[model samples]
Target: MKHLAALNKYFWKYRFRLLAGLVFVVLSNYFSVLAPLITKYVVNKLMLLLSPGTTHAFHESVQDPLARVLINRIDRWNFSNVVALCGVTLLVLALLRGLFMFFMRQTIIVMSRHIEFDQKNEVYQHYQRLDTTFYRSHSTGDLMNRITEDVSRVRMFTGPAIMYLVNLLALIGLSVYYMLKDNVALTLYTLAPLPLLAVTIYFVNQLIHKKSERIQALLSDLTTNAQQSYSGIRVIKSFVQEKAMLAFFRNSSEEYKTNALGLAKVEAIYFPAMSFVVGISTLLTILIGGFMYIRDPQSMTFGTLTEFVLFINMLMFPVSAIGSVASMTQRAAASQKRLNEFLRLQPEIRDKPKATPKVIAGDLHFDHVSFTYSHTGIKALTDFDLHIRKGQKVAIIGRTGSGKTTVAQLLLRMFDPDQGAVKVDGTDIRDITLKSLREQISYVPQDVFLFSDTVRGNILFGNPVATMDQVRQAAKQAVVDGEIAGFAEGYDTMIGERGVTLSGGQKQRVSIARALIKDPRVIVMDDCLSAVDARTEREIIGQLYEYLQDKTAIIITHRIFSLFQFDQVVVLDDGHIIERGTHDSLLEAGGYYADLYARQRERDERPSEEEVTQEK
Candidate 1:
């Protein structure tokens, strides 16, 4: 019932189809009730005519127009005409019942399929609107199952389970009403075990519900493990850890097997118990009705006894079907709970209300900005303030986790500062739409991720509408155009997942070209040149520097040569700026930068001499 109200919005749109299906179920149940009554009429009416002394009396008693015409056709007719009329009525009702049933099945199928499509699309669109930080804390497999398997469960429950329950209730209501009308005393005796059967089914359903939850959880875990193993298969193969990976998978499979067997054990017991209840109901019907008929054969007619027996048989399927639907509904409810939990979580970051997109002029500022990922007050950056004007290149140097990447993330609005302001073009970034702010700058991350696509497709990712000539120009600036052209298909060659067909350096170059294609006012390169050789790195940077001289650029790198080309450099140690000046001025100040430059120069002069090294 938690998400029931929310789900009903979708239900209302398809209410017409659902109403039509329900009408068919009612009509079908009505026809089924008619079968018992028709049988009773034939038995009682035929007995009177065939009693050996009432042939003329039976023919005179038929005063109805349809009956008189049939009776007039025969001389000394007994019960054959009456039997033939009942058969024709039954055949007509059967045909009409089949027509309604066909409509019911088709409408339910169409309604459920459309609902599934809408739910899946809604989930995907909602996921895109969520903040990137949400993805950082969740796995790919978990989200995949929510969209694939969880939506599937909702679809199945809505279609077959809902229809079956409606039909079962209709059948039970009509059957009981007719049974009581035939003979109240006989109905009481036959239904005496109904309460006991209901109680037993209730307990069995509760057991299955708990076991089914466990099985769903186990299935999710197994899916996560399999997805992770497949994504990291290259690492396993390279390290020759195939046997170890297999052992882990075998253990996960065993856990899945255990939970599945637990569910099976409950179902195995429940089905047979249902059958046993139906058997007992049958036994009671025959015993009580048979005794009453023998004691006073004239008091109880043959037609009434036949109707009672037919109604008892109808109860078998409804009771069993109700239990099956209950089990499926519980599983669907569990899946719905998980999916709603994800959809309700508010993203940690959002644009301000009434915020507008602002055009930036390439001037950036951080004023007394302090930040911590933890609301518990562990600071990642403290009182951080810096200014970079247009047409200036600034390089930041720091050890890993010394808050270097945090600077880039904060600038991109990945998270907001705990206290203080980050302004671009003299306007606070928090006051502008994120789309407008991010559009002015391009970021090349430390780790390059390429899709399974063509070389040209990857390069022009930032600008999909770019022409082929522009794509080639961007690739040429990245210094990998020649290498790509040598391939069998040149720019048309397909790259495997994450560019498995390319080397680390090649992938990094492709990432750089993607950023370059955007042609933004500012560029932030976070160790973007780490994988390439020195000569190629220099050539790429030389071409990039000429084109980027008039744009604001921030370069973070471990290479002293990469930093020397920048106009100004800032040295950060322990989340505090230790030195900030031009490349020559920093060396003249004889601070951290001076010492780092001296050590690097010595390394170039002599490889055998060992000295202090910074780990990043």
Candidate 2:
């Protein structure tokens, strides 16, 4: 009940709708319960009227105290007319019940959907606010299940479970009042099985909640298995590991199935436990009421007994629904706990209360900065210091683990440094609002990520309000306009997920266009030209130097010759600056940079066997 109480605010959000739906439920129940009372009156009339010349004493005490008034009218009318009148009244009540029931579903269940929509939006919005470190520590599949499946379970609790539970309480209260008024002893007998039924439901729900939470957790694992397999399908096929991956998926699926069945087993036991109690109460009513009726009709009359059975039949619907409500209640509790936990998480990298907003000039500095990844606890950069003047173009060249990308990450404030500060334009980056800092810089990483949308949409993703002319200019600068024009729908064509439909070079160029459209104060290109041909790379570089004039730029590259045009090149090895200079100066020094340049130039000059054979 406490778990359910947490959803009251969502219900209150649509207070008018919730009130209207419950009012309809009440009206529907009024009509439904009215039918049985009419049956009780008509039956007693038939028994007495058919047995003509019965004692006036017996006729005086009909089931209803107000029956004497209706009987005086009935005496003038024949039995056939009286029975037909009751039939018409019952038919009208049934129709009214059905009409209100429809409106009840429309109001309450539909409001639940509105709440669900709001809940999912809040979860997604929070995910956006969390820093990159949160995502690196979490799995994509697990996050998806939390927002989708868990929210759905909470919705069920808000809507259908609430409706049923309310109806159950109301029906039982109303039935108890009438039962006690008619026969206290019989009502006491009927309620005897209730406590046991309640006890059974309590223990059963405990089992249900425990198993459902486990099942939901296992479902997340299964989702992760499927997501990883599909994302790495190409690699699996290339390495001939299909069978191994398939076995892994099979094992995950079996675990999910086994846990699901375990929940189903407890659910299976719950229903019969409720039904067995219902059956015992029904058997007792018939047996006890029959003996009392035979002993004296006044004490427990035939019409009275029939009416009592009808009320019990009416009570059976909500009572029988207890099994389903219990199951749903347990599942909802687990899901609500899971969703609330996620919502309560505070992002570690959020801006301070008084963080300032400022336009950046992009004069960046790393002042003896040091950082280590949270998971590995090993320093990525230690006592590292560098400074770039505003509007300067600097290149960082490093091997795979030598921390080239870490520089871009720190500048973006994806994670705060452990020891020292990162500054932009004389102010520590921690003082700047995250939105203001990120908006001033454009980053194009080595591995491109494009949404499943049109090429034009992907390019304009950074600056959604950019015009067609601006879009075309950016595309041309990145050298992807010609390829886009050849597509059947041009800019409107749907590129598949992560730009899988495009070639690697085309994907990289589109990512470059995405960054170019931002028109930011600073730009970071992290090996973004690795997929493009050497000629295209050189052309892009020539165009960038002109188009991105006066903007601070960091170009991380492996092409040693490409470093010649840069204002400065800093070579890194094992998180230390190993070499620094222009191509001419480094060559004269005959250091690591010179050796790398000579080796790459020789490799390029050497022809392949196919070219050598053709020459011969």
Question: Each candidate's TM vs. the true structure?
Answer: 0.88, 0.95
Model 1 ranges with Cα > 4 A deviation: 3-5, 43-95, 296-300, 375-378, 561-564, 599-616
Give the least accurate 10-residue stretch of model 1, judged by summed lDDT: 54-63
- lDDT score for candidate 2 against the true structure: 0.84
The numbered model that scores best in lDDT is 2
Q: Rate the local accuracy (lDDT) of all candidates.
A: 0.79, 0.84
RMSD of each predicted structure: 5.0, 2.4
What lDDT is obtained when candidate 1 is compared to the true structure?
0.79
The residue-by-residue lDDT of candidate 1 on 1-616, one tens digit each, is: 4543456867898999888889988988777777766676666666665564533232343223443454455424456765776688778778877887788888876788888898899899889878867887777777888898888888877788888888888988888877776567888888888798788777887787677667767777778888988989989999999999889888988988988888778777777777787778778878888888778655556667877778778768877776677777767776777778878887777788977899777888878888887634557788888898977888988777677777888888888988888888888899999899888889998888999999998988878888999888898999889999999999999999889999999999999999998999988888888899767887988888887878998887766664337877888776677789888888889988888888877866653323334321
Candidate 2, 1-616: lDDT as tens digits: 6666667788789999999988888777766766666676677667667765644333343444434455556656777998887788778889998999898888889988998998899889999998888898888888989999988998887789878877777667766776787789988997799999989888888899999999899888889889998888889999999999999999999999999998888888878777788778888888899899889766776666777788787878788889888888889889888877777888878898889998998899988888898977767887778888898888898788888888899999998999889999989999999999999899998889999999999999979999999998999999989989999999998999889899999999999999999999999999999998767877788779887688999998776745337777888887778888776777788988888888888987788788899999
Cα displacement (Å) at residue 216, model 2: 0.3
Give the Cα-based TM-score of candidate 2 against the true structure: 0.95
